[model samples]
Target: MSEAVISLSNAFIYQKENLILSDVNFSINKGEFVYLIGKTGSGKSSLLKTLYADLWLEKGHGKVAGFELENIKYKEIPFLRRKIGIIFQDFQLLPDRNVLQNLRFFMEAMGWDDKMKIDDRIMEVLELVGLPDVLKKHPHQLSGGEQQRIAIARALLNHPEILLADEPTGNLDPEKSIEILKLFFKINEVSDTAVLMATHELGLIERFPRRTLYCDGGIINDLTGNS
Candidate 1:
């Protein structure tokens, strides 16, 4: 497989009628952790959305986890998602369901059939996020950090090669944010899963500097490369 987990060149992003960003170009290698920073309304989210096939790459070329964006059909979107994990700022968990049920829902939707394997995978991911014992706990019962950890666990269920997290710590306190950051570090270190995180928390960025992508004036610039 290609070492470039994500690759985009000469790409243009649009959010309906208006163009959101243009001349986008970047590539994320395997097992790399990258921070994406920009102010609100910047093209950070749009870039991510394009990568995940959430929004079509209306012009130019792109590939993620081995799928070509230019020729991707609607039916193949779910398969592309299988190779990547997506976490949003909001927890977006099923509020009414407990931890186990929430995870099982995704597993079944992803086409896992064996009950035994699904049960095993849930515990495995929960353990990775340090929440092995909270199978019955609902989102409301957990702390913000715990809830985010649960969200992380859900994302990891498929063991995706790349994790796309959008402002994951946006809803947490400083201490909680630090904890979540550490959890992300732990995941990256242990699993060697490439991470593309979109966040505005400069403090965390300062404390744990990495290759960064900045979005401004409708372009995504690679701070680690010649821009």
Candidate 2:
């Protein structure tokens, strides 16, 4: 087994007065493809948010990609984010930017200075996500699957240690969903990038047969046979 990339101990998350997640705990091993399954409003998204530092932890300990998440300094967020890739159900691609430009924007924001290096990396990741020829295509021009692939490629640009995908295939058709899942599987097999995906699709869950983390009643349960 690989080392633990993400570890949570008695973690609690709250929004205003509501306790969205309580006493939740789990450790994600490096290169492991795990599924976070639950119904809506069941703290699935909240957990991912906390893992990526989008939401601050209200209590307990959490570490992501070797960075402490609890009480993490505001200035360190960008650094933490650099080691962790986050994918949203909504493709957050820039409307005005083509695929290449959109990826360039992220590399620039991350303080990448070499133009040639940035262009090369973008092409490499685009090809990794199977969108080599779509660099000049705008998000609107691509199909749902293509747009999502671009998003995945953008996430890979930084070579994140772990990929947190929140309902990545939610907007895709079944065929496209399978394709995206296969892409993620390929990523894990090739790069050993740990993937923690939150989704409501039980069919995919059963088909892929990864370790399962089910969120229910303010707790996380590992239903995989190993445990």
Candidate 3:
């Protein structure tokens, strides 16, 4: 049996007091690559947030990276996050810090204190993202795609079990977007890390199809059925 890294059943997702999605059901097995698609207001982000425990799962059962979403405690949020990587459309790199510093900061925050190990891990992830030469560059010094690559490298720092990306290619051009998409697939294959990316790029989906979950009408439908 495939090990599920993320599973949601009868899940209700809420943004503050507003309910975004209801009756959500799905399971993403280890090393699986899945897409979440829908219109702008169709709760794709809400669903991702719920999986990562950013938004509370109020009325259903959800499990991610071995952490239960329902009734998760405040102290456990950081630990939950440690087991999952999150990528955002906007590259969230600190402007004042260079690439190496930014990565080191994240590793330290995640409780990695060994200097040599931190440096080695940073180089490993940067190489994995194909940006090993940009260790000394700042975010503004890099192009949109480079910045996004660095963000991806940062997300891989702790060897997360799953990667949660929210429109990671939204800010890039078509060529760069496809490049990023390919990189994600490479990571999925090489690292055996599951990925649940929320995106509206139907063209990319057509180009490289995978199991997809569609969010609409306040509910999630697993289009592939196999999930």
Candidate 4:
């Protein structure tokens, strides 16, 4: 069996006085493609935030990408982030920097210093995402789907064990959405990178069925009803 890449046990999250997530429990094994579905305010983003250490764990236990989340030191967050890739709904690419520069920034931040190796890695991931020709294009120049692909390439800079995508296809039209989804499918099939995506698009879920975790009524239900 594949190892558990992310594990949550009775996890709870709070935003000041109100509880965002309550007693949430789910486990994502290595190379598994899982969908995280919930209505607005269902704590989908908060849950992802908690996993990536964006929000603090007020109660319960959670482990992500081999790092224990609860009571984790602030300084360790960067290290934890290194093991995971996070994709946001809004492509967070720099407005001025070209594709290669944006990717290089992340590599540099992650302590990659060799210029030759950095260029090679950037090219490798861009190719992996089918954007080999986009290295010179600015974010504004690329189409919506192309920009999202660049974001995915940026996320792959570290070859992370897991990819946490929050509404990755939210901004695209249906056709483009499918294109991005297929890209994700290809990535998972080829690299065995576990993908935990939070999305409202049920069509994609129906089209490419996989393990699902549904969030509703302040509770998370693993569709398989298993831990």
Candidate 5:
């Protein structure tokens, strides 16, 4: 049986006093690639934020990468985040730094002490993402797809158990989006990392169908129940 990477049971996600999603319940198993599909403002991002501890779990229970969310302490959040990777629509690479330097900075921040180990890991992730020679390139020197590839490489650097991607392909063209989606699938298959990717592009879903969860009207419907 596959291990559970993310789980939410009767959870309520809120932004301040406003409830975004109600009674959220789902389990994404390890090595499973699940698509989170919904319209804009339909609570996809809210649910992902709650899982990553960006937003507090106001009610019920949630667990991600072995961290309990219902009662997670404030200071314990960083520790929780270290176990999972988060990707965004925007490729938030530092402008002044080259790709290698950026990855090194993140590794240092993530508490990688040995320089040799960090360098080895950088190469590993770059190779994993199928771009091994762009370490010297700046974010501005790369195309949108390359920048996103760097973001994915950075996300994989820490060997996260789960990757929480919010609109990762939202900013790319159709071809580029398909390439990014393929990379995600490759990562899921090769590294056994569970992925919960939130996107509104149903075309991508139809092109690369996995189990899908639909968010609407403050409710999440698991379209592939018991699969």
Candidate 6:
């Protein structure tokens, strides 16, 4: 049997007091690559937030990277996050710090204390993202593609078993977006890290088809397919 890195059975998703999605059930196995598609206001972000423990899972059974979402405590959230990588729509790199510092800060926050290992991991992820030489550049210094690459590298620092990306290529041009997607596939192949990327780009999906989960009408539909 395939190992499920993310599993949700009879889950209810919410944003504050608003109920967004209900009866959600799905399991993303380890080393799989799945796209999340939906229109705006379709609860895509809410579902992703719930998976990452940003928004609490109010009802149902949910497990991510071995952590039980329904009963996860406040203190355990950080540890849960360490086993799962998260990327955002906006390249949320710190403007004041260079790439190395930004990644180092994240590693430190994740409890990485060895300076040598931190530097090595940063270099390794950057190489994987095809941006090994941007360590000295700040967020403002790099182009949109470069900044997003840095974000990808940052997420990979802990050797996460699954990557949860919310509109990772939303800010880039079509060419850059494709580049980023290709890089993501490469990472997926090489590291066997399962990816759940939320995107609205039907064109990209058409071009690079894979198993997909669609969010719409307050529900999630599995558009399962061969990669």
Candidate topping lDDT: 6
- Tens digit per residue, CA lDDT, model 6, 1-227: 88999999999999999999989999999999999999999999999999989999999999999999999999999999999899998988988999999999999999999999999999999989998898898899899999999999999999999999999999999999999999999999999999999999999999999999999999899987432
**Which stretches of candidate 2 lie above 4 Å from their native place?**
225-227
C-alpha RMSD by candidate, in order: 1.4, 1.1, 0.7, 0.9, 0.9, 1.4
The reply for model 4, stretches above 4 Å from the true place, is: none
lDDT of 5: 0.93
What is the C-alpha lDDT profile of model 5 across 1-20, one tens digit per residue? Answer: 88898989999999999999
Q: Which whole-number lDDT from 0 to 100 does residue 47 have in model 6? A: 96
lDDT by residue for model 4 (1-227), tens: 87999999988887776897788888998898999999988989988988999888888998998888997899999999999999999999999999989999989999899999999999999899988998788999999899999999999889899999999999999999999999998999999999999999999999888888998988899886667
Worst 10 residues of 2 by lDDT: 218-227
TM-score of each candidate structure, all chains considered together: 0.97, 0.97, 0.98, 0.98, 0.98, 0.98
Taking all chains together, the TM-score of candidate 3 against the true structure is: 0.98
What residue runs in model 6 are displaced by over 4 Å at the alpha carbon?
Answer: 225-227
Give the alpha carbon lDDT tens digit for every residue of 1-227 in model 2.
66899999999987767899888778988899999999999999999989988899889999998889897999999999999989999989999999889999999987888999999999899888888998788999999999999999989989999999999999999999999999999999999999999999999988888899999998888898532
Better of 1 and 4 by TM-score: 4
Q: Candidate 3 lDDT, tens digit per residue, 23-139? A: 888899999999999999999888888887778889989999889899789899999999999999999999999999999999999999999999999989989999889989999
Candidate 1 residue lDDT tens string, 67-143: 99988999999999999999988988999999999999999998899999999999999988888999998999999
Quality of model 3 by C-alpha lDDT: 0.93
* Steric clash pairs (candidate 2): none
After superposition, candidate 3 runs with Cα above 4 Å error: none
Query: Model 5, 13: alpha-carbon shift in Å?
Result: 0.6
**Can you list the residue pairs that collide in candidate 6?**
none
